[model samples]
Target: MIPDATLAALFAAAVAARENAHAPYSRFHVGAAVLSESGAIHAGCNVEVASFPEGWCAETTAIGKLVSAGEKSIRAVVVVAEGDRLTTPCGGCRQRLAEFAAPDTPVHVGGPDGIRRVFTVGELLPASFELEEQP
Candidate 1:
């Protein structure tokens, strides 16, 4: 679990990233920030394209950037949004999170309502996880 201080940092980063969201269709801007085991932070904003299928969610972008940079794991992650209600990771992002985060890994969500809730990656996506067994 990340200390509260780290959570604050990620929260701020997520909020900052939200400003860069490229949503025109839904206009539901969202941001995600992830802390990698290597002590680096990655940020992503949900980008919506006219060809919808080409769009990428903020969580996947952050995780992909971290992994492409050679980070094998993430310590924790925070998500932010501008919705009236608490924003949760979409199913795609949740499944992507399970690939890099262990069941106990922490997921924090926040917005105008404040730090609304925290859940584990496993709790966020509890079914049909595609995890490989370790020796």
Candidate 2:
């Protein structure tokens, strides 16, 4: 289980990032934060473009920042959005996260109110593709 303080910090960062998301096309702003093994938190928001598929997910952006900072291991993750339902990472993000996060790494999903659900990397993608598993 993630510590209360760490969870709070992640949530705050995700929410703040969501507020700055550039989603003029979809108007569906989303933010994500990842806690690295070294205890550093990285946050990023979704960016939408007119080209649709070219835009990246919030988790992808956060992971990019984490990797750019030289952190390769993820301890936990938090995602926040402005809807009543929970907003978890997409399939591609699940794979991206699995690249750096262990199977047991916790992924917290939150709405405007607060966290609503928690899932592990394995739970989200039981058969996540791994390069090492390839023939």
Candidate 3:
């Protein structure tokens, strides 16, 4: 579990980022934030494109921010969306997250009210594909 302060910060950042989502087509805005191992928080909002499947998810964008900053590990993640169900990361985003997140990394899904559910990445994506570590 992440520290209370960190969790709060992540949620706040994700909420703030939702305002910038470029979803003219779907109009389903989403935002996500990741807490890096170095204590930095990276936030991203979903960007949509005219071409279907070309758009990227909020989680992927957040991971992009973390990677762009030279961070290789994610400590925790928070996803916020306006919907009846909790805004969990998609399968592709889950796999992308798994690349940098440990099995125990916390994944929080939130609705308009607040966080509705939380799960470890491993729990969400059981038996994730992992390459053998090379020495």
Candidate 4:
């Protein structure tokens, strides 16, 4: 298990990114922060559009940044929602996260004290989605 400090930092980064969320349609803001094995932190917010499908998930954005930064894998992630609810990564984002993060990787959902949640990729996404696979 990773230290509490690491999860705390990731949550803080997620909150910062949430401020950048652009959800004009649903008005649901979201943020995500991904941690790489090399200790680089990448943050992203949901970018929505009228076309809908054109918008990107916060997790995907963070993953894109991580990839651009030459990260081969993700160690952990934190997600935050605008409201004080137990918001988690959407299904698509879960699949994407499973691509890079191990099943045991940590994922923290930030919200009001009573609404916060935390789960692993396996817990959120379950099993049997193809990402990069072992030979």
Candidate 5:
């Protein structure tokens, strides 16, 4: 579990990022924030393209920022979306996050009403597919 203050900050960042989302098609703006191992917070908003399936999720964008900043590990992550209901990361984003976050990393979901739920990466994606050396 992460500190309450840190989690609050993550949630705030995600909410703020959602304002910049370019989701004209779906009109479902989403934002995500990643807390790196070094305690740096990175944020991103969803970007939608005219071509379906070419859109980028907020979580993926935030993870990209984390990697661009030279961080290889994520300690925690939060996602926020429009409306009163919380929004969790999609399956693809969950898998992408697994690449940099431990299975026990905290994943917070929130909405305008604030954090609605929290779960570990493993809980969100049980038995995640991972590559291992097969000697």
Candidate 6:
């Protein structure tokens, strides 16, 4: 389990990033923050373009930043969005996260008020596809 303080910090980062989301079409702003194995936190907001299906999810952006920074593993993640129900990562984002985060990695879902739910990567993506490492 992630420490309370660490979770709080991730939540705050995610919330702050959410403010910059560009979702003029869907109007569904979302933010995601990832805690890398190096103890660095990276945050990103959803970016939607005029062309449908060309936009990227918050998790995708966060993962991209993590990889660009030379981080290969994720310790934890938090996603924040405002809605009646908790907004967890979509299917594609879940797969994207699983590429870097272990099955036991914590994935927290939050709303405007506060965190609403916490799930493991395995829980969200059971039987996920994994590539075999080459020696």
- 35-67 per-residue lDDT for model 5 (tens digits): 998999999999999998899999999999999
Across 34-114, the per-residue lDDT of candidate 3 in tens digits comes to 999999999999999999879999999999999999999999999999979776889999999999999899999996578
Q: Residue-wise lDDT of candidate 2 within 1-135, one digit each (tens)?
A: 789999999999999999999999889999999999999999999999999879999999999999999989999999999878878899999999999999999999998689999999999999998876566
Rank by TM-score (best first): 6, 2, 3, 5, 1, 4
TM for every model, in the order presented, reads 0.90, 0.96, 0.95, 0.89, 0.94, 0.97
Q: How far is candidate 2 from the true structure (C-alpha RMSD, Å)?
A: 1.8
Model 6, range 13-117, lDDT digits (tens) per residue? 999999999999999999999999888999999999999889999999999999999998999999999897889899999999999999999999988788888
C-alpha root-mean-square deviation, each candidate: 1.8, 1.8, 1.1, 2.2, 1.6, 0.8
Task: Specify the highest-TM-score model's number.
Answer: 6
Give the per-residue lDDT of model 4 (tens digit) for 1-135.
667787777878888888889899988888899999998889999999999789998888999999999997989888888665578888989999988899998888876232276799999988747746579
Ranking by lDDT: 2, 6, 3, 5, 1, 4
Candidate 6: global Cα-lDDT?
A: 0.93
Provide the lDDT at 82 for model 6. 80
Q: What TM-score does candidate 2 get on C-alpha atoms?
A: 0.96
Model 5 gets an lDDT of: 0.91
Give the higher-lDDT candidate: 2 or 4: 2
lDDT of 4: 0.84
lDDT of each: 0.85, 0.94, 0.92, 0.84, 0.91, 0.93
Given candidate 2, what's the lDDT at residue 12? 92
Off by over 4 Å in 1: 131-135
The runs of at least 3 residues in candidate 3 whose Cα sits more than 4 Å from the true structure, single-residue gaps closed, are none
